[model samples]
Target: MKFSAVLALSAAVMASAKSVRNHYPVRRESHKKGASSELQSQLPAGMAGFGVSNTQVTEVIIIWTNPGAGAPTININPPAGGAQPPAAAPPPAAPAAPAAPPAAPPAAGPQTHHVTVGGPSGLVFVPDQIKANVGDMVVFTFMSQNHTATQSAFATPCDPLPGGMNSGFMANPNNSVTPPPQVAMQVMVSDPLWFYCAQANHCGKGMTFSINPTAAKTQAMFQSMAIQQKGKGAQSPITGGAPPAANPATPAAPSSPPAAAPPAEAPPAANPAAPAAPPAAGGGVQTGTGQINGNGACVCAVTCTAGSFPAAVQGVGSFGGMAGSLPMNMMEA
Candidate 1:
């Protein structure tokens, strides 16, 4: 009776086990359907069909089967003919630095040049040529003889330029004057400047100077031209005045009138024609006694009666006595 009881209990347990196995398959099918639906809903819009693939489902199942595995790498390829997500933008770059400043200019300064005029070297400008810039000073110190520092033209070295500078004749005769004479000329331009001594014959002797001479117009060429000009120079200052004038001539003397004949005088009884009154004594006419003439006219030995003529004619006709009046015939003679 105990055996029979054991058999019945075993049969009952077997039947219950069969029923559980049958229900497990049906429940598993439902769970799979639900999981597929949920997976499709979670997928991005338009990617629902991607999850429907058996391969994608298997991958999902593998991922769920191993929960302890490292995170899965999902590489979602872009759909054909569909807009894709924009890639994340890269970061921006940094800024640049500033530049440096410029440099400054140099300074300007003036200078001076010294020159000797007519020194012991003779009629010349010692160091006759020099270079000078604008605003520079040129001091010309005279040494000997009478000399001048006069501005001249390059073309005509001996001739003075109109309105040009001139240090009038500075005479240092024998170089005896103290401190001598000096002339200061400022360099007004960078071009060539010609100068010469204006004293007579000095320029002709090659006494010349120059400032800023050039290759084409050198100081030697200027001196040569000055010498070729000979000793001619500007008017001399020694006269201290203008030129002089001319002279004039003199006048002649006047003539006198004739006097009336005096009363006739009787002839001397001793001689037929009174011996002609003794000829007046001196070389010129002399006064003598009166004599009667054959024509009954008074005859006097002198050309005029004493005291009869003007004072101007007193000693003109007679040597020692006053002049007298003459007869008309004698005056005519």
Candidate 2:
């Protein structure tokens, strides 16, 4: 009897379970259909038929007006052509810095030119004339004894030109002092300038130099004028910007003894036609190894007031070393 009671209870439990199972499926289907209908009603007429497929879920974008204040009403769809809006134009690039004109190459530095104040042949300045610009420096190396690099005017070669520069006397005869002495001066002007040895009569003997002379104002003309002036160089400081003076007088040629001729028109007499006196033999002559009056060696001879020395000297003879100073013998005579 107990076994039969147990069997009846089991049957009752089974039937109740079956009824709950059947109702669960029906509720699930109804809930799903309600959700689908609500979604379709909210969609626009154009998107009404666009529903999620059984295999895949549809994507929808909802746009709301005045965010946080209004509900979403429009659904944004991706463009059909798949084209994207161009990104905002990059902020106008800062105007390209005007291409720096290739920086002008720095102006060339002032040039330094070297000139021998007196070469081996002491009577004359080596490369006596030169062309120099305003910024250039001309170094005059006084390599010999008893000489001065003095500034003078083209019009007055031996005499100082106003506003000119002068290098004081540098007497290095026999390389007597150590370190081989020299004097230097910068070319401060572009116009023609003249220089000479101011030691006594050096200027008269053709110890002169020039810079940037014009066609009309030439080096030869200046030397000729200096020989005529026959003046000593006055003390001058280094300076520039002096107005040029009138052209100097041409130098008179040394008069030679008249050739034996018929006494018809005699040549005009030269007032100071004395023969060039030769410098003393030893030590008095600075540059070359010859007598000034020897073989027409010296043309323009002048007296030296600065010590017992040759007042002037010149490189006139054929010998490369043939320079002549005021001959002591000539001075004695």
Candidate 3:
């Protein structure tokens, strides 16, 4: 709304006033090329006060330069506030408790050390790089097409802005909108850093740039990040791979004692159940009527009857007269 008012005032000034001058907050910035409205180009990292809490900004003043104007062709004015009608105005906010420290003057820290960036030919800013010292300060002031001094670093591996990095607050929604980012930038290293449009194809061609106190190996890194980003744009990510399943440990089987021997020529069932005893070699035994035959080596049950089991135990209860090996066989012989 304030911007609309400033624009309205601009149109109004173009009509009657000899030279219109308005007051905006003060700021420091750089020059750009082919810019439509008076605008400041690329700003620094902390200008919007992202990470560093010790940072501060004082003012923002928009100075429109007229082509072929008189002595003071410059019209420095603060952003106007009458754009939105009262109907559009928000209700007045209730006053709150005074600030603990109260409001300090705008000149809290060093208000100098100008940082500005330029585009390309047929563009607005040139080189489009803004660099500053660690302790130095910068002020930005401009009004032109959609532009910004994004307050995030050029992360490696081209990782998308981690959840909280890019605030998305300063990015201009529309193309021709001018959202001036008055921020203070400090180059921690004498080395330069590169930045680009997070937008789709805007930075791919030649819309990329760098900032450093001195020339170094930053250009190579920038090119590397760009290449990786381009590769990701080619195809989708890998699929069909999942973490391996865990192997469950098998439980150990319980060990058992060897089988006992069968009783020697036992009487028939009517003779009464015999108590089980240790097995004789090459023999079988019975426990509470359960007969346990010894295998050749490990005593389990039965004998070499390995190939295919008989329909019944070979000599089991021969006393029943089913097998000729019964004691009655001896009597009959």
Candidate 4:
């Protein structure tokens, strides 16, 4: 019941109040789709100890309309009064936003585009990563370079390329390598973008970077990489590919065992008969014609014969006081 009464009173209070208006400059044409808001205030009626009492305001709102290419048209209003409005109704409860710390002024009057950088590996330069703003119409030069200063837009399935929702404009610089009349694109503060050095593997070399993005997240990513490097590794979180096998042995061929014993001398005999070495099978003499008076020795008289079993030795074969017709160690004569 009380809530209903308060609502009625709030409406009545707003109906009786007066309003004032004035011009508030629009941010810029680039901020066409952008929006800005502010808060205003009204003080209590009197000075301290004299007649000051904090009163509640009824309500406050910003009414915006378009202003053409010429001087901007604006109106700042203050709510009217009847039975002192509640404190909640005037300007906003929140204070006016502090003016943005002024951006560094553009280089003295369009200085020559002395600052020149390359597109990494034929890749288009990523926008926000380049650290430029809407008014910064930068010229990026390429050489058979496939680089583009593309926008990082806020579209569903978020993409950073030719098509994007919150995209900043892009431009290509003209150089001897590129065609004449260098190109450029002025960027806006509202977008984030990324790019690569397209000549395969260039980005992996750290040829890629970004600008004026949500600074902290990138800082953490890079910082972590650095901290890890202090230990080991230069890039992402993954660690780099194991140690070898133990020693192995080979076998040798089997060898023959040494001989058992040295040879011995033949035993000497007492009456060793002259070895009748049966006439050397391949070289011997027949004795059919000779009379074997005694078998002591044999001699070669007329029938000259060679002897065997003794090299360079002469022998005599005789019996019964006659020279036996026999040869010593004979051969077929």
Residue range 1-333, candidate 1, lDDT tens digits: 799999999999999999999887665467889997886565323232321223332110000100011323232333222323222121122236437644644424444466777868898887788877665556566767877777778989888765565655666778775555554445556778888988888888778899889999888777766765664432223212233444544555566666878979987677476666755543355545555656565545544234345546545646764355444454443
TM-score rank order: 1, 2, 3, 4
State which candidate, 2 or 4, has the greater lDDT. Answer: 2
| Better structure of 1 and 4 per TM-score | 1
Poorest 10 consecutive residues by lDDT, candidate 1: 59-68
User: Can you tell me which runs of candidate 4 are displaced by over 4 Å?
Assistant: 1-131, 144-146, 152-159, 165-182, 219-333
lDDT of 3 at 12: 83
- Assess every candidate by TM-score: 0.37, 0.36, 0.28, 0.25
Better structure of 1 and 3 per lDDT: 1
lDDT of 4 by residue, 71-107 (tens): 2323222212211111211111324766886676755
How far residue 160's Cα lies from its native spot in candidate 4, in Å, is 4.0
> In candidate 3, what are the lDDT values of residues 1-333, reduced to their tens digit?
699999998888686553433333433343334362233222222222232223333112122222111212233222223221111111233358675857657553322333222222321224355554433333322222233333324544233322211212233232222323323333333344444444444343223445562344454455345545654432212212234566897888887977887778856568566788646654233223233465343322232212333455775655642332322222331
Candidate 2 lDDT over 38-86, as tens digits, reads 8656543222223222334322111110111122323333312232311
Each candidate's clash count? 4, 9, 24, 38
Candidate 1 local Cα displacement, residue 111, angstroms: 1.5
Query: What RMSD, rounded to one decimal, does every model reach?
Result: 45.1, 44.6, 26.9, 27.1
Q: After superposition, how far is residue 299 of candidate 4 from its true place, in Å?
A: 99
The TM-score between candidate 2 and the true structure equals 0.36
TM-score of model number 1:
0.37
The model with the greatest TM-score is: 1
Error of 2 at 293 (Å): 99
Order the candidate numbers by lDDT, best to worst. 1, 2, 3, 4
